[model samples]
Structures are given as C-alpha cells and as structure tokens.
Target: MKWTDINNIAIALMDLYPDINPQYVRFTDLYQWVIKLNEFDDEPKRSSEKILEAIQLAWIKDAD
Candidate 1:
C-alpha cells in the first residue's frame, strides 16, 4: 500500500494495533508504524505531513 491509500492504511493500522489510542499517536510514531506494515511498499520520502495527518484522522475514525 502506498502513502496515498489512507483508508486502507488506516484499516491496517486499526487491525494491527487494536489497543492503540489514535488521539495519542504522534506523526513520527505513526510514520514508523506505517512503513513497517508488510503491505506498505512505497518509499518513506513519498509521504508528507498532509498525508500523515490524513491517515491519522482516518485511523481515529476507524478506531471509533
């Protein structure tokens, strides 16, 4: 999955970290977790603050 795939990334995160609190996650932490996902194949440099924030927000919704 690429950085632009926010919904899929968020869903993966929700499943990977079921107990995580999205409200408490930092972007740096989120970035690391995302890159480590087995399905995540894009370069880290392709990501930006906007994408990260979008993923975080989506993950928050998924968590809810």
Candidate 2:
C-alpha cells in the first residue's frame, strides 16, 4: 500500500497493534510500523508529517 491508502493501513495497524491507542502513537513509531507492514511497499522519504497524521487519525477511527 502507498502513503495515501490510509484506510487499508489503518486496518493493518489495528490488526498489528490491537492493544495500542492510535491517538497516543508517536509519529516515529508509526512510521517504523508502517514501513514494516508486509503489504506496504513505498519510499520512506515519501512519507510526511501530514500523511502520518492522516494515517494516525484513520487508525483511531478504525479502532472505534
């Protein structure tokens, strides 16, 4: 998945870290986890603070 695939990445994050609260997640940790996702394949440099924030927000929604 690419940086824009927020929903898909959110679902994966939910599955990968079911006990963690997305709202409390640090961007650095989030970035590492995202790049490690098996289905994810993209340039790390492509990710930005805004994109990470979107992913975090989506994951928070998914958790709900």
Candidate 3:
C-alpha cells in the first residue's frame, strides 16, 4: 500500500496495533511503522506530513 492508500493503511495499523491509540502516535513512529509494513510498497520519500495526518485521522476513526 502506498501513502495514498490511507484507509487500507489505517486498517492495517489498527490490526497491528490494536492496543495503541492512534491519536497519541508520533508522526516519526507512524512513518517508520508504515514503511515497515509488509504490504506497504512505495517510495518512502513520497510521504508528507499531510499524508501522515490523513492516515492518523483514518486510524482514529477506525479505532472508534
């Protein structure tokens, strides 16, 4: 999944970190985690703060 796949990334994150609160996640850690996902396939440099924010927001909503 690429950075544009926000919803898919959020779902994967929720599955991987069910006990973690996305609202409290640091962007740096989030970036690392996303890049580390086996299903994630994209240029790391393609990510931006805006994209990260969208992923976090989606994860937050999914967690609720």
Report the number of the highest-TM-score candidate.
3
TM-score of each: 0.96, 0.97, 0.99
Candidate 2 local distance difference test against the native? 0.95
Q: Which stretches of candidate 2 lie over 4 Å from their true place?
A: none
Q: Report the C-alpha lDDT of model 1 over 1-64, residue by residue, as the tens digit.
A: 9998999999999999999998899999999999999999999999899999999999999888
* Model 1 / residue 23 / CA error / Å: 1.1
Question: How many Å off is the CA of 45 in candidate 1?
Answer: 0.7
Backbone clashes, candidate 3? 0
lDDT of each: 0.95, 0.95, 0.98
lDDT of 2 by residue, 1-64 (tens): 9998999999999999999999999999999999999999899899999999999999998889
Write down the worst ten-residue block by lDDT for model 1.
16-25
- Put the candidates in TM-score order, highest first: 3, 2, 1
